[model samples]
Target: MPIANQNLFNQSRSFYLVSILELWQRFSYYGLQCILPLYFVWQLELTLADAFRLFSTYVALAFGFISVGRWLGEQILGIKRTLLLGSLLMMAGYVLLVLSTHKNGLIYFGLATISVGNGLFKTNPVALLSDIYNRTRFTLYHTLACLGSITAIILTPWVAHHYDWNIAFSLGVFGMFLVIIHLIFGKHYLNQYGTLTDQQPVSLKVGLLVSAIITAAIVFSSFLLHHQTAAPWILVVLFIANILFYWQKLINLKSAMRRKMMIVFILLLMVFVFFTLYLQIPTSLNFFAIHHVSHQVMGISFLPEQFQALNPIWIVITAPMLAALYNRLGNYLPIPHKLAIGMVLCSSSFLVLPWGATFSDSSGFISAHWLILSYALHSIGHPSISALGLIIVNRMVPAELKNFTTSMCFFTFAAAALTAGKVATQTIAPLYANSPYISLALYSEWFMKIGIVTAVIAVLMVISAPLIHRVMQSNQP
Candidate 1:
């Protein structure tokens, strides 16, 4: 048997070498996200509606690519080749981004390229880590991954707000070059983690059908919900077809007969609901921050994307403390209790942001400090949910199917972004059109309303928490 790598804590080794390499990739990814809106509006001169819609589409499409990636990793390419090609594609993407920004239509094209690269690259990194560590140690690996995300969130906005957006994007180009180096040298560190789930062969036709069907469902879901938009007729038809295909599989699979699969599928659906609300932080909140809040600190105006930086900042400061607290509380405090508390914390953050929105007069802007607090509270709320989520999914799924299941978890995230786009069209768009200045107050009211909804989700989760815990624990050896 091949010797397992030594423990990271005991040895001078860490997943950090890999984490640092991964960090640069995220630096590029989040850095681009930070500047995308400004580039669209300030540089590309899109209307706020146009910019928001387009931005929403870019993000929706980004996560959507992961399903494509998951397939290739399993069937045709395998994770190693897929991840390498993805890394190179991302580098070329950054290069193309620089090249694309100068030409019309090219920026979206460039983002699509980068998003595809991420679909290809992002999934495998954690899968690689899984190959190295056990469930308990995987917590530490996840912490490292979370750390990278936090670093990107804080730094991306700071780079953009401090410098020009193009310069911010240029930093991505540099980050990608670094990724090329890391992937080349880190071959020895990574090659051991061979593709675990690639053994279950899936055909290209099946994969393509899956993609086509999912696309159709999203479209049909939008239509069934009475969302009025300019989507073409052909597109709508396809959307319906895709929904039917998935619905049939869901019914036929009798996943309940497979206990673990049923629980996972349900959890994924709940996560979808969570993501719909959460994804709004990027798209809808962008406008909410730009228009509603009052602010000035040392003459710097806080932007919406900057709000996203808040959660990560919280994670960096609070994760270790929370980890420590969990250790101290272990064997006494119930996991459900901890989770419920976190969910309440999450809802209140939104509640606070809306309060700030309402407080701002049509002409009177609110201070950035309000936003800062909102973000901080959100930061606290996130790690609580995230830590629990990973634990549940990892422990419950069959060992061999972990990659596919994890991809489903992220798929919820992507689905949420897509749902948020639709929600944006429903809530924010109409409110803005009807009320205009009055919409600010309406949104504040809406934020508070959403908080109630989130609190309910938290409450429901709390009530069900013991049951979930029991189900998860019983499934394990």
Candidate 2:
């Protein structure tokens, strides 16, 4: 091969390795996610409020600890080793999940372990890819993640139904095992990359400090999972602390960089809002599907978890087209405008649910088509905001701070997950005590209120797009 061609091939090879790892990692993660609430409700016999609280806390901590993971990768282990360590930890977590089928207390520990491992594993690969490639690959990578999610959403539930939850959880164990095996075999391709910390010698003090921090984080995560009521206060404190930390950091940057960082913070807030709405999928929406939506479509029975597949399935269909359109439009469209469009779609998704409720049959069960439509809109809206938000933050931050900034993006997600949990616990869970028909009406009303609020936000975002766009285009630091 020509020199340029060989380099391109090698880069592509490395990208594929990272992307595939993401694919399987998401497979494992989403597989567990799809079943977790159900597991808490049915297997562990928790109330809806408690279930959502645990689920949200687990999710919040998973993303929350990404900052710690990035620190480890940057300051101690280097990205490659950190990634390996995380995968191994995730495998252990999954193993504990399988064991939890017999010993219920093990589930909290299992979830805590997975959360920490996810924190470590999530951002490093993207950081590694950003180091090697200049072009934005967020859409492509997210599509791969969606693919993994779709497969997991479909299969995990089926496995749990046909076989057992232990076997289903074991699928995650197998997925992580594959991730570890692939990482080991593929390390050579990535050796030239993610080595920023490899040359630095770790002192015993630093190593011990890092270990202590990780242990404390795990313990805190497990505590939150077990003690659901404490989550709200803890999340609020974390959220405020994150904002203050970023605010202080933002003011210290050069003028142009400061402006860009300001926009990044704005976008992150938007992400928090977006995910707070989107996360209803695995919690309230899943419950809605099980209780209110018709399970039979064309004489075929579908599991509630299987319906979660619709979002990813829609993404798989729409992502390439959206990517192509974005490429074709080039700089004509700004990121803020795209995000505004997403917010509009998200609002519309919920708005349609209330309208769809009117068409319910005598049994108070709505057609699955309503959910299909809702998910379609939700999926299309995701890449516009979440994927672009990541790309924007990655582009705006200083090189040294890239991993940390990326982790901060995940931190917004963490806050959003916590908020979503609160929403579920406070809003949706209470409706569960009502009859299904009354709950359906109340759910629609709540959905309408959310839709209206998001619609208002979308309008504001649209109005602000030009200003944000101009700021983004101003002089670089």
Go through the candidates in order and give each one's C-alpha lDDT.
0.64, 0.84
Q: Give the TM-score of candidate 2.
A: 0.92
The C-alpha stretches of model 2 lying farther than 4 A from their native spots are: 1-11, 136-138, 199-209, 251-259, 395-407, 426-434
Worst 10 contiguous positions by lDDT, candidate 2: 1-10
- Write the residue-wise lDDT of candidate 2 on 1-477 in tens digits: 111113353446777788888999999999999999998888888888888878988888888888888878877889988888899889999999998755657888889999999999987888777766755666676777678888999999999989999999999999999999999998877766776686567779977887787788778888888887787787678677867887888778898888888888888889989999988999988988987899877889899789999988999999899889988988898887898999999999999988999998877789999999999999899889887877678677778666656766777888899889877764463534556667788788888988999999999999999988888777667
Q: Report the C-alpha lDDT of model 1 over 1-477, residue by residue, as the tens digit.
A: 245466546521325545655677777887777557556777778665666566655665567567666666766667766667677767776776677645655555566667677877776766555565644555455556556566666666677677755566677888778877877776676655657544445578866864564445334433322322432233345444644543454455434424555566666665666667666666666667766665455687555566666656667677777878988999575665676777788788878876676566556466677777877777676666666766767766666567656756665565566566666544454523654556566567767877898888888877887776666556343
TM-score of each: 0.78, 0.92
| Pairs of residues clashing in candidate 1 | 213-242, 216-239, 293-366, 294-365, 294-366, 294-367, 295-366
Question: Highest TM-score, which number?
Answer: 2
